[model samples]
Target: MSIENPQPLSINSMAALVTLGKFLEEDQWFPQLLENKRIYRVTYSGKNGQFVCFAQIMNKTSIIMCMEETYESKVQW
Candidate 1:
């Protein structure tokens, strides 16, 4: 059987994930988090309508890597 390896996360990306996880845990929303294929997407809204940060969670590690922004806003604040 072939083994698949998980990607390593950058320092900034890992930190952001930890922070986001903590916030979600405190808010009791962490359980609702889901992994969509290789990317973990969370529905969030800011000053704009809606946005999502696509991330990959490393297996057997606490690292989370931000891949790319799934949504873009044409309206400039």
Candidate 2:
């Protein structure tokens, strides 16, 4: 049996998600929050892993973003 090399792909995918989160905030790309009521969660998946990019738009020029990932081999977040 041939072992699958999935680490590189998973890691790359994780990095991309993180980059996306940063991009969402860079240059004030996100739209202004409508009275504390604007949030978005983006999900991405690879061969053996998946991740989420979470961002909250606070106001016209205020936003926060965070990324989280999980792999098939990992037991915890």
Best TM-score goes to which candidate?
A: 1
Candidate achieving the largest lDDT: 1
Candidate 1 lDDT over residue span 1-77, tens digit each: 11244465567666666666666668644323454333445556656556555444444444444444545555555
Off by over 4 Å in 1: 1-3, 32-77
Point out the worst 10-residue segment of candidate 2 by lDDT: 1-10
In model 1, the worst 10-residue window by lDDT is: 29-38
Give all candidates' CA lDDT scores: 0.51, 0.48
Per-residue error (Å), model 1, residue 23: 0.9
Off by over 4 Å in 2: 1-36, 69-77
